[model samples]
Target: MSAWDRTTSREQVLTRIRKLAEIGKISDTGVSRLAMTPLDRQAVELARQWMKEAGMSVRLDAAGNLIGRLESPVAPDAPVLMLGSHLDTQPYAGRFDGIIGVLGAIEAVHAFVSEGLVPQRPIEVVAFSDEEGCRFNKGIFGSRAMVGRLEEGELERVDGDGITRSEALSIFGGDSARLDEAKYAKGSIAAYLELHIEQGPVLESLDAACGLVTGISGPLWLTVELHGFAGHAGSVPMSMRRDALAGAARIIAGLQDLVRAEAGTPAVGTAGTLQLFPGSRNIIPERVQFTIDLRDMDMERRNRLEAKLRELIDEVAADNGLTYSIREDTNSPPRYCDPELMDVIRLEANGMGLQLPELMSGPFHDALALSYACPYAMIFVRSKDGISHNPQEYSSADDIAEGVELLYRTMRSLALSIQGERSGGKWESTTA
Candidate 1:
C-alpha cells in the first residue's frame, strides 16, 4: 500500500470502480451497460466528471469517444501519448473488464498533475465507445474510427433493437456523418498504452499479480449459415433427414478437433453463438446460423486451421444435404507491442519490486486498434479464476493497485522524457 503512496491511490481506484459498477448492476456483480444506451451515457458522464477533476479538458469526439486532454505546458502542439480502453460492457459482463483501464489512466494523470510535473507532449485519456461490439456485432468501433480503419457501411450496421449505428451515434452526442473528421492524423499519437484484466488463468497459475503483454493475438470472426429442407421430426426417417442444425453441430464439434490438432500451441477456436430456424420441438431445423471465433499467435498456423475448418463445413453440409455459406466479419493479424515501451514498463515494474511475466493477450482490446495508429503496449492485472465477460469476473484490489502503480510510473517517465522541443508537431523519440 505504501508503494502506491507516491502516486496512485488504491482506494480511490477501487472506489470509482464500485461506483461505476452500480450504474448498470444486474445480479450481484453483473453489468449490462451496452454502448450508445442511456446507461452507457450516464457512465460516461460520471467518468467525465472524474477526468475534469483530474485537470483535463474533455470532449466527446464525432465517433462517440469520450476524450480528456491534459495539454503539456511545454509542447502544447506535440503528438499526444494516449491511454485508455472502452467503457461499454458485454450484456452480462463484470465491472472490471474495461473499467480499470479507464479509471487507472485517469488516476495516473491525476497523480502526475498533482506532483506538479508537466509532460512534453499532451496526454489524453479516452473511454473508447463500443469496444464490446455485442450490440452492433462490430467491436472496436471508436478506436477503428480514430485510426481511420473503419470498414465501409459500418454506420449502417444494426443492433438487435433495430437501431442503426448512425442513429445510435447521433443520440449519443456524436455526428455520424462527421466520423471521418474524428480520425487522428498520421503520427498524431506518439504511443498508446492500456491496462486490462488477463481474462485467463495464466497469471494466477504462475503466481503473478501483474504481467507485461508481448502482443495481441488477433481474432478471426466468421458467421456461418446452413440451409436445408424442413420436415416433421418424427415422420422424417433419420437417413432421409436434411437437418441444418445437425450439420452446424458437426462443424462446431469438428472445429474443436481441428484446433486441437495443433497440440501444445496457442491455437484455439470457439462457436460461442448459434441459432436454429423454426426452433420447435417437433420441427426439423431448416436453417442454422452460428459464429466462429478463431485465434493464434502464429498467423500461418491459424490460416492452415481455417482452411481445414472450411473443408469440414463443406463436408458436413454435403452429407446433410445442406447448402452453406461463410461470411468473414473480421480478419486481423497479430500486433506486437513496442520493445522500447516494454523496456520502459519493465524498468518501472522492477523499481516497484515486481518481476512481471511477459505473455501474449488472447482477447483483443482497444490497444489492438491503436496499434495501427502508433506503437502500443499493455499491462495486465491478474483475474480471479480467469473469469471475464461474466458476473463472476474478479480482480483483487492489491493486484490492481500493483498494475496501476506500474502504469503511473511508466506514464510519468515517458511523459517527462518527451519534454523538450517538437518537430512538425511530433516529439522526437528519446529512447534510441
Candidate 2:
C-alpha cells in the first residue's frame, strides 16, 4: 500500500509464454506441452534465447534440464541461488503450472540487469524436464536425478507404447544412459525456489494474489482389478452368474463411502478410469478394472486409506465370488518445505505490501521432489478458479507479474545473504 515499487519489470517473460500460446506453438488441447516433445523443445530453445538476452550464460544438463547462470558480486563459485520450474505440461494443461516459474526466473535476471541490482551469490534459473509424468509414468525424473534418487531400475521403465527410458531420452534428443550423471554433489547447491499457479481455487476464492506453500501432498496411484466369470445376463441366475461388474460396482460405491466417511477433512479420492470387458448387452461383464488416485499431505492418513481400500477390495471381491488383486502402482511420500525459508518468503511478500496465505499444496509437483535435494520452497499464484491442466486455466497478467516480483525479491535476498556469509560480511535484512 505504501507506494509499492520494488517490483521488477518482467512483462516480457509473461508476453513470451503467452505469445507461444497464441500461435499453434501450443497443442490443440489448451495445454499439451509434454516434455521432450516438439513444443517442449521449442520452449527450451526460447528459454535459451531469453537467458542470453537477459545477460546470463545458458547450458543444458544431461537430463535435459536447462540452466541459465547469472554472475554475482560475490565469489565466482559462490553458492548459487537456484530457481526453477518445469517447462513440460499435461495434455491440454493450463499455461502457468511450471512454465511461469522458469520464465519468471528469467524475468528476475532481466530485472537485475535493468535495475542494476546485484546480489552476493550468482543466480541460476532452470527448466526441469518430464515433471508432468504424462509421457513417462515416472515424474520429477529430472529432479530425482538431481537429488541422486533415481534408482537404476527406473531407467528400465518402458512407457505405455513399449518405449524404453533410453529410447524416450533419445527421441527427446537427450541421452538416457547419462541420466545418472545429472546428479550433483551434496551441499553443492545453496538453495532453490520455484513459482507455480495454485491449481486449486483457494487463493482466488480468498482474493489473495500470492500464496506461500507450506507443504506438498504425496500422490498414490492404485490399480484395482476384479475378475469374475463371463456369462449371459438373461440365462444365468443371480446366484449362478459370477458377476464381476456387479462386484466392482458395489466396491466402487463402497470406495466412495469409505472416503467420505474416513477421509481427512480435506482429503479426497478419485476412481477416474474404469474399464469393463466384453461389451455385450446380454452377457454379464466378466472383468472390471479401474484406477484410484489418492492424495493427502499426511502420510499416515494416506497409508491408512490405502490399507482400508485393500481390505475393502478383498472383502468385496471374495464376497461376490470374484478374483481380485491390489497393487500400488506408485506413491511418493509427502514433502514439507523449509520452514525458515518460508518465513523469509512471507516477510518479503508482506514487505512488498502483498497479501498471502500459508497453504499446503494438494497437487504433486517437481518442487515437492526437489525439496529433498535442497532447501526448496514454492510460491503459488492464484488461478482463475481451481481449474488447471486444461485450456480454460488462466491468471491475469498483473497477478502473474506480481508473483514474479516476489520471486525476484526472495531470490535476490537469498543470494545476497549467501554472499554476505562467504565474504564475512553482513546483509541488513532489508525486506523490501
Each model's TM-score, in the order given?
0.86, 0.87
TM-score of structure candidate 2: 0.87
Compared with the true structure, all predictions reach lDDT values of 0.91, 0.78
Q: Tens digits of per-residue lDDT for model 1 on 180-255?
A: 8899999889899999999999899999999999999978999999999899988999999999999998999999
lDDT of 2 at 382: 92
Clashing residue pairs, candidate 2?
Answer: 31-92, 31-93, 201-386
lDDT of candidate 2 over 145-254, digit per residue (tens): 78877765776777777777677667666677777677777766777899999988889888998899988877899888888999877888887877888888887787
**Best by the TM-score measure:** 2
Candidate 1, superposed: residue stretches over 4 Å from native: 1-8, 223-251, 274-290, 311-327, 419-432
